[model samples]
Target: MPTHTDQVPETPRRRPPLGPEHRWVILGVGVAAQASFSAMFSGIPVTAITMRADYGLSTGELGLVLGCTALGVAASDIVWGLLTDRFGDRRILLTGLISTGALLVLMSLAVVPTGDGRPPMPLLAAGLLLAGVLGGSVNGSSGRAVMTWFREGQRGLAMSIRQTAIPVGGAVGVALLPWLAASHGFRPVYAVLAAFCLVTAVATWKWLHEPDDAPQGGGGTAGEPVRERSPLRSREVWRLALASALLSVPQMAVLTFAAIFLHDAEHAGAVAGPLVVLVGQLGGGAARVWSGRYTDRHGNRRGYFRTVGALSGVVIACAAGLTLAGAPVLLTASALAAGGVLANAWHGVAYTEIATMAGARRAGAALGLEGTTLFTVGFVVPLAIPVLLEQSSWSVVWAVAALAPLLGVPLAPGRRP
Candidate 1:
């Protein structure tokens, strides 16, 4: 028998399992991973002018190229969700980040600069589409990881934090990409993005680990029976997906064209246009965090979601009217900030609700279904925005986009269907 000082120090008390600290670590990892993916896709619109001028792409062709990313994301979301549910979040996220980085690098290499210094449009579009397919892995896997790590009470806050990565990354990209494209060229922009992704992949491989207590192959609440049925069959799931899709139209509209609108319609300079987008992104990120905290404290995710949606509709409509009335640039920028914040605030709450409804085991599939619906609409909205701008005016486009969120107010979950 060992003496009092020789008993191996009682195994150092096993460190009591890390408690809340581990959850935050998980959150940080999720945010970084999601942001890496978002930067690549969200940065595209900020470079629209450069791409248009370089490649001689018309409005229609540019929209098509941007929409291709959404199409690829929609197509692959479900597949990635299935894989996440089957194998777990760590493996899925690692695979996605690594593969996506490699694909982006390949796209950079495939760029055949014409006399005008732009890659062939077809090749560029195809490259983006392929990158998007790999990037879809980020959403489902990161979401599932957060859900598994946090308790029910903390989920709204945690999910909101994860969701904030979208706008936060967009803010960074919108600020950086335009300047990079202006100074160095498009190829350097992509190279930097690829490097960011690869670095995130290595970090994830090193730091992200599956929770030991989490259920294997399924992610429901403790003792809850794992549901093998498709989450698509649930009415709540379908309604939530529809509402998310509808609300996303306005959000995507602003993201895809706000800079262009500022430059062309408002007669703002190149730097001024992206600056407005950057402001909107920052405001949207803060709104998401606040909304998440509020919903968590109040336990009213559905109600908060509906309220934000209705507010977004009003804001967008008002913004459109003001623009038509020749509002000052400052006023228009404020309107974009308001509209973007309200429009984006609901994503965290909406995603948390879907995961809770589906339970931990089926959270991946549920989230995937939501992604598919949202991105399918996202794919179409970009294509339509150009047509709307050409046939009508920016006023009409904003007014029409407003209707989507207003319709979503009644759709928010409450009483039985």
Candidate 2:
């Protein structure tokens, strides 16, 4: 008879723990993936002038076209989130990036203007809508992947770093796309954006991955009952999602229209408009990073989120007042910067809270739901802004936006929830 050791099957060797370098690697890949999609979506506003000139579109028409992308995103965000939950982040992200890039290329080919200089608005809108559908994959997949890699204590910082990609990508798009559209035309801008998506797709395929030991459905501790298996059923999740969606109103308002406001209302120069947007984005990115760090150390995610929202309300209220009073350009710009920074700073923390509430297994779905709500807001807000501007002044618009964040304060999750 064989001894116990000789008769027993050999245990499979465990994979080595991720090294220090791996953390940064994951963070870099996540940031890159998020940034590519962010640039594509946020870049739309930068091309408004070019599109208006080439396609003979009015401000309302252009706003409608831009809003189409958000509608697409809202429609698909939850589906992509569910996909990430089922198929894993790597596959979903790669599929999204590659397919979205291909669609962008198709849009460049199929949606151009004719001899009459009138583009088929419906077709262009459809293309952007389709692109938004594909582009929705980035946020959930990238966020889930980062969550798997980072420990709970470090998640706020990691997610914040990932979130910073939005403003960073937007800043780049705002800085580069306008000039490209002015000099080279819309087709080149589309092609360049497609190239970025493709390149990032390749990079993500190479570098992005979930932890080997990650759990499915609910990231549970050993022997712990799965707490967030049905994230949609949880009332807390709904509350948080609602608050996030409401808070996004002001942020999107500034992002989509700040440059136009600066140029048209404030009479700031062309260069000054984009420059201010770029600076605001930089400030927003920094605030996100700082907020993430603060939340991680303080361990009060909800409080931090509420505090940021309240502060955003104050800043935007002040900005509305300044704009209405015809304050100096410097004062108006400062208010915009402060509002943008505070409004945007809460995103990472809010996402972290969602992920925490849902657990790892269900985080994709939770994030997807939140994204869906926020993108729905994004879709509606742009369309509404034009109508608001038509009916009222920029001051009226800003004043209304200021109220959005304040509305979110009461909805912010509590420590237990």
TM-score of each: 0.92, 0.92
Q: Stretches of candidate 1 above 4 Å error?
A: 1-20, 112-117, 219-225, 415-417
lDDT accuracy of residue 266 in candidate 2:
85
Candidate 1, residue 21: how far the Cα is off, in Å? 2.8
- lDDT for position 387 in model 1: 95
Question: How large is the C-alpha RMSD of every model relative to the true structure?
Answer: 4.6, 4.5
CA shift at 133, candidate 1, in angstroms?
Answer: 0.6
Model 2: ten consecutive residues of lowest lDDT: 216-225
Clashes of each: 4, 1
Cα lDDT of candidate 2 equals 0.83
Give residue 217's lDDT in candidate 2 (0 to 100): 47
Candidate 1 has an lDDT of: 0.83
lDDT of all the models against the reference?
0.83, 0.83
lDDT of 1 by residue, 1-417 (tens): 778888665555433454546778888889998888888777877888887777679989999988888888899998999899988888999999998899877776766354556677888889888888998999999999898888778899999999999889878788888788777677777887889789988878866766667666565445555677778788888898888888887888888888788888988878776776776678888888988888889898888888888889999998898888998988876787678777878898899999888887888988888888888876898899999988999989889888989997787677322
